[model samples]
Each structure stands twice: as C-alpha cells, then as structure tokens.
Target: MQQRAAITLALASLLAIGLSGCGASEAVETSPTSTSGQGSTTYPLTIDNCGTQTVVTAPPQRVVSLDQDSTEILLSLGLADHLVGTASWTDPVLDSLAAANSGVPRLSDNAPSYEVVLGTDPDFVTASFGRHFAQGGVASRERFAETGIGSYLSPTDCDNGISINGGGTRTHALTIDALYEEITELGAIFDVPDRAATLIDGLKTRAAAATEGVDFAGATVAFWFADTKTPYMAGGLSAAGLLAKTVDLDNVFSSSPEDWPATTWEAVADRDPHVLVLGDLQRDRFPGDRLDDKISFLESDPLTQTIDAVRNKRYIVLHGAELNPSIRFVDGLEKIQSWLREHKDEL
Candidate 1:
C-alpha cells in the first residue's frame, strides 16, 4: 500500500505538538463567519498549533503543495486557484496528475528548500514527510511559522516517528478508519464537507457491496507487490486490508507486525497465498522504455512461477494511485469492485 508524509493538510488529534508556534487570538471578528449552506452545518475553522487558533475569513489564496498526492487532492477539489507552487520527492507527475501540475512553480527538483517555500509567499505549505521534520534543517515546522506560512502534515502519514523491521518506514501505522478520517478532515478543512462525506460514504458502500455474500475464513491471499526483487507485504489496517475486506478475501500478510513491511520470497513461500495483488511492478514504475531491461528479471524470479497466485492467475494488478490512501482511495475501491466482479465466479 502507498502512503504519504508529504504533509498535505494533517488532521489528527496530536498527542504532542510539534514545533508550530503560538499565535494569539486576534480581536474577535464582530460577525463570525456563517458556515452553513442550505441547512448544512458550518464550522468556525480554527487552524491551530498547541491550543491556539488561526482562522481565515476566506479560502486560502496562496497554497504551496509539497507532496504530489496532496497537490492531486487540491486539484481534485478544484482548488488550483490557491496553488502558488507544488513539489515532490518521488517521480514527477503522472499523466493523469499533469493537467493541474503544469505551469505551477516547481519548489525543488526534489523537495524545494524552505527558502524556496518562503519565496513563493505561500499562505499554506502542504507536506507531512517525516524526513522534513525528523531530520530537521531542510524544512522544519519552525521554518513554516517564521515565514507566516501555515504547514500541514498529511494525517495519513501517521507513522509520525515509528520504525519498522524492514528497510522502509510506514505511516500512522495504517488503518482503514484513518483513511476515512483523512478524507473527512480534508473535506472540513477545505470547506467541502459535503463532498468528503459523500466520497467516504460511497467508499464504505462499495467496499461492503464487494464482500456482501462471500466468506474468506478458508482463503489466504497476499496483498502482494511483486516488485523490486522482494515481495512487499501489507498488514491488516492497510489499504490492502481494506481491499481484502472489500472482497472477503484473507490477506496472508495480515499478520505482519508492522504495516507495509518488506517480506521475503521465502516468507511468501511459507504462507503461500492463493491470491496476489501485483501492481507495483517495474513495468508499471516506468512508463515506456525507461525500465524495460528489468522485464526479464521480473519474469525470471523464482517467486514468479512458484507462487500459487501465479499458477492459478489470482493476481490483482492495481493502478499506482490505488495503493495510496487519499481521496483517490475511492477510485481504488471502484477498481477492486470491478476486478472482483470479473472474477466472482472463482470465489
């Protein structure tokens, strides 16, 4: 499963406040903002840090997006007018995400420096990558405040500072509920509470629809990512777990102690799942001839042929974005719905 720490507006009940400094409440606005729309509720949003509140009279006008996924959400919400810039630490914008990305200032070739962030005169800086904070000096919470720029961490990237056994790190330790929570939070923060509620409700409905009549007590599957020479395993509480629940399939990797831990082929052989979710392949990572040389390696891996998922062809190849938990998460549920329907006969 994919996760983000790109600090897209974070929405958690923080146990310990980060470096966000305090801003005294402004003299009360004689007339508080009316947040209602046709009987809908309006909340007086207080963007705070450590018990203090910062209210904006209108929607943000100068937003600097630090993570691509967060940028995607802003675009999805039709909030590009607020964008002053966008940046990413990983690959550049995929074609689907390019329309919104064009012409916007690039903060960095790979994560623009805080000075660059300041230069944009951004009102809001979106990012939650732990490295941005945990490994300080690059762009600490202090930097955002010093520049009068508000910083938002991705609430989904909750791994705050937790470490995993494998090489890679995981986020907020992962939970389906967390995914829904993030969407709802984004909705409220962006003043599109209705859309957030609608999207989340649709996901729950679709996931339930996919698993309605099936049983999975006897079946064991792998939330498999057969890429990068090793088998990446997804733990329960991850997007894959949510995916498994959607289809009433058991993910053999459900027992992983850490979320999204790297499991070896030997481990896969030991559990030998009946199904495989294999999207994050090398071919998928590269669009054209960029990574073609590794095609033979992927095909020749011993795990390729011996896994039951391969022989029985119970593999599920998902779109790259599907693996991540975001508003796009609903898109993932849709894909799963279609895939399960296409293979419902097997179940």
Candidate 2:
C-alpha cells in the first residue's frame, strides 16, 4: 500500500462526499463510439472516470502524464504526440516507453507540484493513483474542473463504492480486464477507438499464450514488495495475485483485505511460500527498497531462512513497473509462467 498522508485525505474526502466504499461500476463491455475507417476524429466524449464525470470536448492536445503506467498507455495507443509532459516516480525509465515518446519533456522526477504541472499548460492530466488529486497535491478534482482541465484516474485506484475491512476502501483489485477497460476508455476520450480495440486484441492474445498449458496447481507464491520493517505484501486482489491465478500458483496472501497490505514477518513465515517474487525497486528514488537487501534479509535472518523458499533460494526478481496495473501486466504473467516452467522441479 502507498503509505502517504495524501491517500488518507483522499479517503476522508470520499467519506465526506457520502461515497460508500463497497462496490464498483461494471466494466466497459463495448468500445467507445468512433468514425471507423474514415480516419476522421470523433469527440465531445464524456466518461465516468473513477466516479468523476469527465467530459472531453475534443482530443486533448497537450496531455500531462503523472505516472509511468499512464505514460505507457498513452504511448501504446500511438498518442505520444498528445503528451507534452511525463513524470517518473518509483519505476526507472523504461526503454520502450522512453523510445516511443523520445523528446517529450519530463515535468518532474516524481509527482510534480501543482504549480509545475500547471506550468506545462496541459489540457488533460492522467494519473494511476487517486491521491494525485489530493488537496495538498494537485488540489482536488473540482479544482481542475474549474480550470477547464480534465483529469482521469486508473479505475484500479478507485474505491468510491468498494468496501474493506476497517470501514475504508481497499485498492480496487487489479486484473487484465481492468487494464483493457482503461485502454478502451482512454481511446474513446482521444478519438482512437479502433486503435484501442486493436491493442486490447493483441494484449488478450498475449495473455492467452502466456497461460497455455501451464500447470502451477501445487505451487504457492509470495510477491514481496517492501521490507520487514512493515513488509508490504501483494494481496490476492492485486495485479500480482491475478497473474498468480492465471499461472495457477496460489497466492499465499490471498486472504488479506487490502490489495497491498502491511504484513507480519511471522505470518509470512507461517505461510512459507514456495517461491518469493521480489519487486526490484529503484533504490536511489526509493531509498531502502532494494531487491538485494530483501534477498540478504531472507537468507541471513534466522527465522526467515528456515522457510522452504529461503533455504532453497527460490526467488524471482520482478521490475516494480511490471507488477503495477498496466499494459505490461501480460508481460509479467508471461515471465512468471516461463520461470515456473523452467523451474518446475522447485515446486
């Protein structure tokens, strides 16, 4: 989970607005309307994005991406021309994403201040996290609306109607369907319905190929994102969990309520996963979140070393970006299955 004051404020705002965090809207089953085969653009699009009503009167010409996942989406749809700025936070510069939008200016190394974002004169802003619109962050959704600037959040970050254990909303479970819905929705807003459809079809094919003939019935996996200080675990409702399901590996933390929850080392020890998937975060940007550090702890700690996975050194290093709710989710799934096939005996 993202431990930040901004998220706390966002949850409080949701409650203040009488949004009960218990359910989610149905997935978008149809592609947005388009002037197919004509090459002409369609517009005046209106979408209910993360419970916020967003209307784009025309294609957004100057877009600002506040997250890597959103940046990848814009580029994947051949909408790089519309992006005027992009930001980087947890993930490093992905070669494919960087090459797609070669000269697009980077507005910030991380989430930019509201002033810096406004300096770019963006007509639209897209983010993967809901806290991007917090009061002390980019202000609020209404504030952006007042300025005639449209904003969008990834549905996986939305909890408007989804309920959780402690009277708050857990991060919406990330899945392949959620990724497709986001791409399709963005396509409609940008007048590129056909492109979105084509992309989704390709992604679906990739996903299918990744899971074909894979049998992971007896294996159990744990996606460890952070350290023992307050070990951040990827719960069953997360993208990682969904990928585990696709590969047939049981997620050890599937019972946790939060998508990314602070877990106890003792609990992890008890579960004793068969494989440990390490999230290789950028240490410079995220100080202590190094993959090596986690490995060392698992191997050296007396208690942790006793676990079967630790003793066997069965670890899979995953780029943090691949694990996020993004287009690369399929790629992540493929990697996991391929690894399992190569090391089937480990199970």
Candidate 3:
C-alpha cells in the first residue's frame, strides 16, 4: 500500500507540473482518451498528434505503417486497401486480418529506411513507438512534413513521456482508452470515423465480457516481457499493469515508474509473485525473446527456480503485441481472466 501511495503521489506531481504552464490554454492536456467525434472526416483535416500538428489534405490513399501495431489497427479499420507498405513486425499478423494483410506489401521485417518507405509513394505514415521517429528511426515527424507527407505517432508513446532510448517510462498508468483514441484519430485521418467507433465499441464490449464475474484480487503477479540476465518486467504504467488491475491482480512491481524496467532476478524472486505472465514474443532480438527459452531459464536458474510462480508452474503466456499498448491488449486481458478463473482453486 505504501508503494502504491508513493506512485500515486508521483503521478499527481507530474500532472500538476504539466498543467502548471504559463497559461492553461497553452498547456497540452493529455487526456487518457481522445475527444474526436464519430462523424466522417472532412478534407484538409488537422490533427494535433503527440505535440505535432499533422495536416491531412485528404483521406490517405497510400499509407505506410512503421510498426505491426499500427498496421494491425489500419487493417482492422478495413484500410488495407489504402496501406501501400508496412514494416517492423514482431509477430505474425492476427489471423482475422490475414487476408487483408496479404494484399499489402511488407516493407521490411524490421524498420525500413526512409528512402525505402518513400519509394512506395506514400502520402501518410503511422508508427506505434516514438523510437520510429527518433535518430535511428525512419525519419522524424518534421522531416516527413518537410517532404509534404503527414505522419502520426501513437499517443501512448508521447502522452506517457516514453523515451526513445529504451522501453521508456510512464508517469501514470495506461488504459485501453488510449488505444480507443488512436483508433478514433486514425479513423478520422482516413475518413472512416464510423469504423473507428465500431472498433472501440466492440473492444469495450469484449473487455467487459472478459472481466465479468472475474476477480483475482490480492493475487500478486509479475509480467516478464523479455531478456533473462536483466529481465524487462512490467511496471505500473503499462498495458500489463492495466491487465493486472482489470482482473484485480496486484502487480508485484507496480511501484516502478518505468514501463518495462530492467531488473535483477533477485529483485523479482524477492517479491515472489504468485503468478507469472510471460510474453511469448516471436522476435529474435534478445536471448529470452522465445517462450521456450524463458521457461527453460525460469526452471533452471537457481534464483528464479525457487520462486513461488516458477515452483508452482503458474504461468499465463501472451503474444508479444498483447503486452504492448495496442488493440491486442484486450486479448491479453481476456486470456489472463480466463487463466485466473480456471486456476482459482490452485492459487
């Protein structure tokens, strides 16, 4: 309780500082959700996305998404016809979206170069992480604008102050509302506001159904995203935290402010989480990216082997994208809810 109180206070202080600008109007209010309407978007739409004003002259007919999350969202909106190219994938495309996704071109299995993206003659671009617009990314928003192309960075990245250096940090806990806002804004940008509204409504319904009559209150849990030597555990202000909170599961590392903090196995073992939510990432970027590798390490490592979760083999595995702030987050939430219901007696 003391740790949670401190995190609350820290978030309050950050909010106060952000709103205490020279003038209230000058301050950018980072609401958890967007206020975009459900009406169709008019031509020459200007969206204030992540502190940058992106002006779309018309519905983008040739869009290039820099990440899998953004690409999936676009496909969900039935805009695959408009998506000319995509890159930076971590998992296979969602089965429901496979047919639509097949029609689009994969720019690269990873981050594509600026020239390569532009080669598709794209009029608009979208990314799920700030790193895509950073120094090593395809190009900055300013550079895209300079080339007469509009771009959007997911609000989750900028609104939460996620650093481009690593997994980044968050001052406040994130929720599904952020994903709703992204869908709404994207719908408007693509002149498909109704589609966005429908998507948000469906997600809300699914989330409600997932949590209905489910309560795992007081059951401490931990989310291990990747890495074995220095594991990136989920903190309070992330989608994993949201999943834990929704199911009333107490996140062991909720006190940390970083979205995915690199912590020692000793720290995780000390907390001794009752359940372990492992990310089954398909990416081969790191040593522990695979689910089998993660399980092998947990059962073999002396420090982790004795942990309550490892000893009991209480684990819930989710796809890589589900751990990140995106439409797939609901998938993670539902899976966790189901697991808790099935293992109620065991826990």
Candidate 4:
C-alpha cells in the first residue's frame, strides 16, 4: 500500500513541473510590441547631424522642432512637408511656414510637454535647444528612446554649454566656413546637394566681397549688443568677433573673459573703438527710426560723444533677420561694410 502511494505522489510532481514549463513557454511566445510609425518602411533621410556620423536611414517623418532656430533650420532644408508640429519660438518669421502647415496642428503653444508629444504620435523629434531634454521636459532623449523615437541636435548649441541663441556664438575657428559646409551637408540629406552648394558658394562670394577691405587691419571696433541694463557685449571669440572679422574690424572685446561680457561704462571710455556696430537696436523702434535715434543717442550720451564712431556718425544699425544667425548674417556683414564705406572719408 505504501509503495503504491509513493509512486502516485512522484507522478503528481512530474505533472506539476510539466504544466509550469508550458506556462513559461506561452509567456516566451508572446509577440513583442513596437512604436506605431515603423509599420511602414521608414524612408532614409541621411543626416550629417552636425559632426555626428552620417545616419543612413533616420526615421523622422512627423518632426517636432523645439525652438525657433531649429524651426528655421528645418524650413531652410525644405523639409517642411515632414514637419507635423512646432513651438511658438518661431515667432514673427514662420507665420508663412505656419500658414502652409496650419492643417497639421500644433504640438504646443510653448516648448512641448511630453503628453502633447505622445498624443501627436510622432515618429521622431528634433530641436535646436536641449532644454527639452531636461528633467521632466518632453522629448528627453532617454524617454524618447523608451518609445523608439529618434532625436537630432542642431549644431548651433550641442550639449548645452554657454549658448548665445538670438545672438550668434562663434564655436569653431572657421565659423562662417563651417556654417557653409554644414549647409552643404544639409542639402545632401534632403537630396538637394546641388541647390545647397549653389547657395553656400553664393553666400561665400557675397561675404568675401563684403569684407574686401578698404582698411581696418589696424583699427578696433566696439561690437556692442543689448542694453546698458545688462551690458552684453560680444568678445573676440563670439559671433560678434566673426562678424568683425568679416568686416576686417578688430574686436575690442577679445580680452573679455566671457562671450557676452559686462563692462563698466569706464571700460568703454578706455577701449573706445573707431566704429560702433550697434547690432542691437531698440526693440520698440522701427528700422526707419534707427539711424536718426542712434545718431541722436551718440551725440547726446556724454560717454558716447567722445568715441570716434560717434564723432564721425559711423554707427550702423543691423535689423530683421540680418541680426540673427540665419543665412542672412552675411547680408548683415555687407550692410556693415556699406556703412564703413559711407564714412570712409571721416575715418
């Protein structure tokens, strides 16, 4: 009787083990889930990606750019067709880009929240600024990875050091040349390399002509920006410096410790420049009011009246997209050179 009972118990144990194995096998057989957009073959949009290795096939159809520069970059690339949504940072310029894409719907009134991004059902997201990837912000690279969405960073401010956004910051030694090269690279990604090459070469030619100097090889210029409230001026290594180089003006701020450095009114008194490039005009003043008001301010301001630029009326006011880092920067250079030419007799 005992032997029979033991035999039945052994058989029961084996049966239980077999049933557990079947359950484990069923779990293993369940199909893995994936992000929605990859069902269709994701077409290759070859990306130069700033300095990153070329991406052969980047799946970025419904793109959401986080900042104004990123939005403008995308617009310039002629990839507006793939843009699903964008932010308010595009401001006054992209009204036309927006009108054309109005039917596509907005991702956010501001930099997008994660919820808004998810609801849009995006395949990929790209941004000019990295703030979107900060703690709790939408489209953080790590979080996007979880959902199998890709992200691309614009060369303007990679890895988020000291970023001068509206005001351009010079990163590489060959800042202007680098920008042109990157433009060509972008064209390749869009399958419009010829168009990109044409644009770059044309801009380079224009920039070269603008900088073809009468003289400034020995003279320094005060590349002033912003108001006296914050006292922001560009250094020799800043975007202002690059602009100065284009016009062949020596940068007075080369010794400045910071890119946008604050100096005492005394400092301006000390390193007074031959020309004053007032790149930052009064925000409320229209472009037309600039020359007159700047002339008046230079004459009236006790500190400015003694400066060579002020005495000679060599103050130049750069406006619109010219002041921004968009391709129009060369146009700003051309305008500055024109001002210098107009005042050549006095200098």
Candidate 5:
C-alpha cells in the first residue's frame, strides 16, 4: 500500500508540473457529428482519464501503443500513420489491419523497457491494460507524463486494482460501453471523432445483430485463457462475462471477482461446463497458451476427459485479443453466438 501511495504521489507531482502554466483551454462547441462539419478538436485538450488529467496540446503525431488492443484501435481509426512503435502482441494482427500493422515498428512481442520505448521519441503512449504501466512492465504513466508524453490507459482497466503481478479484479460486470468510451476518447485526442463514432456504431450494430433472438438461458460455459494445471477461468466481470451475458450463457466461474482466477481441474470438472471457450494465444508464455495444447490436455486428462464439454468436443476457439476488452471483443461475442446457433439443438 505504501508503494502504491508513493506512485500516486509521484504521478500527482509530475502532472502538476506538466500543467503548471496551462489553465483549461477554451472548449470548442461543435455538433457531435461523425463526419465532415464536425469541428476539429481544440488544442490543449484536457481529458480526465482514469483519475489522471491527460493534456494533449495537439493530435499526437508520433505515438507508441504499448498493447495489441490499443494498437488495433489506433489502426482502426486510420491513425496507423501516426504510430511510431507498437509492442506486446498476444496473437496475430487482425487480417484487415495486417497491411497497416506491418508498417508500424514492433518494439517487442512483450513489454519493452522504458528506455527502449523512449528511444522511439513518441509524443504519446497508450495501453489497454494497467499492467503495462506498472513498474516492472514498461514505465508508470507518471514517468511518461514527466517526459512530456501524453498517455491513455483503457477505462476497462481503471480502478481495477491492477499490478505488475496480477490481472486485477472487477467489482462490476464489463460491457462494451468501456471499450466504446476508449475509442471515443482516443478519437477526441487524435481529432478523429468521426472514425471513432463510425467504429462504435458498427460494433454496436454487429453486437445487436449477433444477440438478436439468441437465448441460452441455462447453458453453462467456461473460458480457459491458459495454464494447463491451474486453468485461468474467466470471472463474471470480465470481457468473457460480457460475451456470456450477451447470449445468456451462465459462466460456471462467474462468482469469482478476479478477472482470471486460477482453478483446479477437479473444480472445473465439478461445474462440468457444457462448452469450453479456449484462447488460441500465439505467445508461448504458458503451457496451455496454444490451442492444440489446451485441446490435448482436455481430451487426455483423466479429470477433464469425463467433463461434458470435453466428452462432446464442444469447444470454441478465440484469438487471445478477443478474450480481452477491445474492438475484437465484439468478434468474440459474434463467434460464440455463432457457435451456440450451430449447437443449440445439442444444448
């Protein structure tokens, strides 16, 4: 707790120094339009983000995205040209964004050192998870602020008690609203509100279409992110929970508050989920990070082989990014919905 307080104090001090002479910039009133005639974002735009006041003097020209989700969000906004560096990928880039992502320099497949990140000379930085800003990951948001670099952390991770060693817990269930807010805020920061709006609308429309008439009232499911021995199961307040709730599927481990809680195979078998949603991560950080490994373990293990999901091979594979709160979360929802449609009769 003392460490956390010190970090907070440092952040406040740095923010104060950064904003020493800057009073609130004039607010520009414009119609909330998503296209032309939408007035440009006024300079010295100040955003109260995750309890930190982020001041953007101008649209970030050289930005460093510290996570895959944030990188994808920027790419979707047509701001790929503004990206100076990107890092921490869990899966392959989305097919549609591959061309643009290929152009951005990859700092690392995981978190890059603070100095390495600074070497890119980025005017702004962004991350989808709070862990990336923790001490051991890259650098604290305060550190970036001290260097005159504006930063944004996804609202989904805000106040979630995240640390370098854990994924954190969520007291309330996550929805697409947080993700939408991130996109909209990033748009405002980049002076591309229209792109953000269009992206949000499209996502909402897709989510609506996916959930239309879809009801799986009593069906039970489990999301396994990684770790073969003590599987990390999704709790109720995560992106996985959002997908389950969207289609009315009950998450077997929904009672847990931790975003990803490690559970014994015996415990998982006790619930005996009707379906298993496995994360197909490209990163090999853990034993079960790969799809084949997860499947092989489920089918071969004595404790899990008898489980209903394993017995029936009712498995749904999702990219690692899809399991996290981001634009691809909508993709995960659609895929799960599609799977249910195909197997509803079995249920």
Candidate 6:
C-alpha cells in the first residue's frame, strides 16, 4: 500500500510539467522501408537474417510460419496461398491471419516438433523470435538448410556478430523502420516488391496522420505487459517502446536495456507515469489478466488510488498483435494516438 501511495505522490508532483509544444503539427516522416525498392530486384537474392545468409533461388510456394507475427506478416503480403502450415501463438487478434489460417494445417499451437514441421513439406519458414531456431527448438538453420528449406527471423530478435542462441548480439532498436524493412524484404523474396512498396507507403501515410494534432513529448507512459507479482515492462528497445515514442511519450522504462524487463511495484511507483498503456495478451494464458483487472488494481489499491492518471482514469489498451513487430505496427500507433487525442486534457 505504501508503494502505491508513493507512486501516486510521485505522479502528483510531476503533473505540473504539462505536455505543450510537444506534438509536431507537420507530418513526421521516415525513410522508406528499404533502399532496394528503387530498382527491380534480381532473383537468387541473398540476404543475412539473424546470422545466416539465405539465398532465395525462387519464390517459395509452401511456407510454414512458427509465430503469430510471422503468420500475420505473410497474410498481409497476400501470401496466404503460399502458407501450407502454421504454428501460431495463442489467440492472435489479427482478423486476416485468423481467416487465412482457418484452412491451413495446424502444425502446432505453439512451436511444432522438428519432425512435425518437416512433415508439412514446407520450402520456407519464418519465426518472429530467434529462440525458435535455437537448439532444442523447432530446428536449427543448418537442419532446415539440409532439407533445402529456407528460414527468416524478424530483425528485432537478431543480434550482430555475437551469437545468442540462433540470433546475433546486435541490439538494434525495434522501430517502424524495422517493420518496413521486414515487409520490403519479404516482398522482394516473394517476387512482389511493388506490392510491398505500396503497403509501406500506405502504412507511413496512416502513421503520419495519426500524429497530426497530438503532442506527446513529456507524457510519462508505462506499458504493463503482464500482471504478475512483479510487473513486466516494455524495454526502450522493443516494439512497444517504439510505439510509446511514436506518440512522443516518455516511457518510464525506456532506459532499461532488456527488451522486456521484470521489475517490482516499487520501480513503477518511482516512475509514476502520467498514462498507463496496457498490453492485452491472450486470456487463456493469463486468465486473470484483463484491462478491467488492471484498472481495478489501480483504483482499489490504497497507494495506487492516489496516482494522478489512475485517479483521473487515464489508461490506454493495446492488443498483443498491435504491440508486436509486424504489419500492424502502424495500426497500433494510430490507435494509441487516437486514444491520446480523446484524452488530450490529461496531457
């Protein structure tokens, strides 16, 4: 209770630093997803993913995606026809992925066994996290290559030269740029560069429009990814961090190096964020984790009840699909920006 009270006090002390002159009225612009979009891409394209250099001799006809983010990406690129099998994370919110996956063979609810994945006869596979390709995981890149299967991992999970599991030690911050790059790369690999370019353009336009009138510079934001004894926070380098920054909010956990850090209630109390951004995950996995439950925690807790944002009922919710690195990143940004617009007075 004392911890919650301290959080409320800290937030009360910071409320006077109002967010003014923080929003950029002019459309904030970013470079195109990739530089290779200028000219036609030649076949047999080889690119380094994670730590492996994969050469695509031709467009893969049968694909198996090991994660929701990868499956959603394939769906967004109109590659549903190419997907022969999939192993999705539980209860992904993307409508198109769900619809496209209806007829697709379920390799597994989570990561499928090596023999099971191989049984799907997939020519290509993609996973959002590098851990999927690690030892004792779905399968290693070498094993896939031995079977003439190509694999790709989302850049967000890759490090540089230093190997961690099946990924590198490169700690590139997950941002819209990375999302665009993934889309563009997949398009080129699938022989649909034009489609990828069009999709990226549309995404950028929507993102720009979402921020038109919203200034978020000084707003302290906290992303509660889970409801455990210790809260899970989105690190400054992850996709959630990028979303927070997109709206110009100062992420309380932005300084943490880990992509998702587990910290105590005292830490959250210290930050006393102005707005709480909750990442809504699947109910099956987190039965008691709901937006209402979190809100209740804030409203009922003696210490937390005094927090300015909680006292005033300022909260924003983002689905897991929207919070992860994938085609829906722009959509997530737009949603949060819209929410902030609705609660502009709180800022």
Q: Pick the candidate with the highest lDDT.
A: 5
**Residues 25-139, model 4: lDDT tens digits:** 0111212221232422232433434333233253356667665555555565455666777774423443435443454456665677787877767666666545576555565
193-296: candidate 6 lDDT, tens digit per residue: 65566666667677778778777867898888776567777878777888877778888999875666788767887788898887666654553256667776
Candidate scoring better on TM-score of 1 and 5: 5
Q: What TM-score does each of the candidates earn?
A: 0.68, 0.83, 0.86, 0.64, 0.87, 0.81
Which is superior by TM-score, 1 or 2? 2
Candidate no. 6 TM-score? 0.81
In model 3, residue pairs whose N, Cα or C atoms come closer than 3 Å (at least 3 residues apart or on different chains), thus clashing, are none
Per-prediction count of colliding residue pairs?
11, 8, 0, 0, 0, 8
Winner by TM-score between candidate 3 and candidate 1: 3
For candidate 4, the per-residue lDDT at 114 reads 83
Q: Which candidate ranks first by TM-score, i.e. highest?
A: 5
Q: How many Å off is the CA of 120 in candidate 2?
A: 0.6
Which 10 successive residues of model 3 have the least lDDT summed? 1-10
Worst 10 residues of 1 by lDDT: 21-30
| Local accuracy of candidate 1 as per-residue lDDT tens digits, 1-347 | 01112222234442111222111111111122223322222333444422223443334568887766577666544456668988753334545446656767777645677777778777766653444544443475555565565555565555543312212355433666755655455555556544545545555665555455555445677765445555467787666666676567787877664556666778877787876665443234332212232234434677656767656766566644456555455555666666666775674
Error of 1 at 221 (Å): 2.3
lDDT string for model 5 (1-347, tens) is 00011112112221221111100111122233232223456545667666666666667778999999999888887777788999999999988788878899999999888999999998889988888777577887888877888788888786444431224556678767778778778877777665666677677777777788788886899999999978999988888888888888889999987778899998999999998999999999889999999999998898899999999999989998999888887788778778877988887
Error of 3 at 215 (Å): 1.2
RMSD of 6: 12.8
> What RMSD does model 2 have?
9.0
Candidate 4 Cα misplacement greater than 4 A, ranges: 1-59, 85-140, 143-149, 156-174, 188-191, 280-301, 320-324
lDDT of 2 by residue, 111-197 (tens): 788888889888888887766776456557677677777887777666663223213456545556667677767766677655666
* Residues forming the 10-long window of minimal summed lDDT in candidate 6: 1-10
